[model samples]
Target: MKKKFILLSGLATSLLLSGCWDINEAQRMYYVDGLGIDYKDGQYEIYLQLINFTNVAKSEYPNPQTVPAEVGQAKGKTLEEALFKLFRSIDQKVFWGHMTFIIFSEEALKDKNALSIIDTVLRYRETRYQIWTYCTQDSIKDILLLTPILNKSLISSKLSTPLDTDDQETFVEPVNFRNLVIGLNEPNHEIGIPYVTINKNWETAEQQGQDTTFIGVGVLSKSGFKGLIKNDAARGMQWMHNRTHRGEITFKLDGDETDFLTVTLEKIKVDIEPLVKNNQVTFEVVVKLNATLNGLKTNVSEDEIRKKIIKEVKKEIRTTYKEALAKDIDIYRLSEHLYRKNVKVWKRLEKDGKIPLTPSSISKLEIDVNQVNSGRKTFTGTFND
Candidate 1:
């Protein structure tokens, strides 16, 4: 009787343990790794990036083979309708649990459509909040079709993992779905998202290769896509953000003939102070950077070097601020600073955003750069003869 009761208990436990009875087979599931969305003619265009798992996971296979990624497209009046249209064409069960990144074209991100897409994605039970977010002005089809060089999987490419390159030298910090959602809710603010382009600066053994690169930042508000901040203005905008990371800088000394210094920035911080008086607001910008001297074309003291860095950094900040104001973009987030520090003043000044920010709005711009000790180390030793 005891043995029979024990056997019965074991059977009950086994029945409870059948948790995966409803699990779908991997072979029957189509894993979506990347998503690209574009808008045209009052319709939503959806593009899906699906890579062969065999090529994506090399170590698991004894002799891994390269497989070109497959991209599919569908259009509809609504995002769901378009998605379902694409679903009707595919034979396998599509899965969103493995989505790595999402790309929004400049057109699709307009008029708060980016927020709409995020809302839809979040509603799906299998969707991820950590998926990297980006916007591009390039061709989505061309980008999805370009495979990684040397048989490498898209898993390792900048398209899927951008911070891999940003860590080396950050231009614009990468944004994720969760980050975008939170940023969109900020009052009177637009977020800086990485702006990408297709670059053909690489070559393979047989032919030139193409890859995706973020040249500047794409600013998006609840109002939707503002515009692209390209070139130095984009880079300088980063230097003013709290997310500023390590990067290289080259600046020439003022009033000098080709006397320049190159340094790699380390721990960087940006601070903004809003001074309001008589219902008038002005922002004071201060930037601090710990940097390592990389190259020097002229001889200068450490103090002079620090001063030169400060001058260059301040100039860059002012330049970016000027450009941002022209486009009605608050790259420095000065509006938020005022809203938090002096709400009443912000209200008065915010009445007419037509000219909320002007060149004179920045009463002060300062920079503090500290140098890290580097170069060949000298060791003293004693030798006996």
Candidate 2:
């Protein structure tokens, strides 16, 4: 009788546990991979790109191209409100658990209260803090539509992502939402985000016989869109942030001033020190880099080339750092470092009104770059030849 009672009770408990909590299957709903937000004329618009499962499945040797997923937009007074408006149109319950990318319009970012708008999305239990956030001067809708030609060429490729770990240094510095928040919450630090501009380069690439295209970058300070950082300035930002994981660096070759020697950054490290004097504040930025002799027009020995490389690399680092500081933007988080290192000093400066220490204060700066390694010799069949 005792055994029978115990078995019956266990069975009842098992039946109650078999509820809908664990039954949500992959096929039951749409998975969103990216979300775009824009603010215009006192209204908010939200964009969602949900993955199409049918296109994701079926792996034949020569499969047909997958159709691009549709984009959904909702508009309202706030981000969540706008998203909810779009949710009403979808059939399956839309799930953002898999979502990893969010783009904000430059205008949206300028609003002093922009944090409140983003808070709803970030505070959601289902949303991941690692989602990459981008700021663009162009319309968020326009930016979304400007997919890379190569990515669109392949049916299986994604248009936008959290941050492509492989090409992080060159194209865009993907800032996850959590990192941005931390930088913002820090007392003395201000946050910087990548600003993108879209053009007809996608179609131009196909017409001009090229597989890839260039997207321009805009700079953003605490005060909305500061200005555009075209070509070198944009690339310089990557160098300053120590985000140049792998990219070409060009300089005049030894004994051949007209010819160019291009070196590729193999590794890099950035360190910073903030010094607060009696009244003036100065920052020391140290960048250590390693590169290989990727290309050269002259036959200078490896050792000779390495010497010239160090001299040129330092000049490049300082020039870039100065230009960024001129814009009053600390693409490098010097303020954040000062806050962590000595909060008391920073507070003292602020209290005495001796230092103009606003969240957006421009830093007085210095830069130092050391080249650790130039190139390697392969022993198998090559030796200084």
**For candidate 1, lDDT tens digit of each residue in 344-369?**
77777673322277789999888877
Off by over 4 Å in 1: 1-19, 59-64, 253-259, 351-355, 372-374, 377-385
lDDT of 2 by residue, 170-282 (tens): 64566677877776665433555666555442445336322212343444433345544455655555555656566666777655558777777656666767777775556
Predicted structure with the largest TM-score when compared to the true one: 1
Query: How close to the true structure is residue 91 of candidate 2, measured as C-alpha lDDT?
Result: 86
Clashing pairs in 1: none
Clashes of each: 0, 0
CA-lDDT, candidates in order? 0.78, 0.59
lDDT of 1: 0.78
Task: Note the residue pairs that clash in candidate 2.
Answer: none
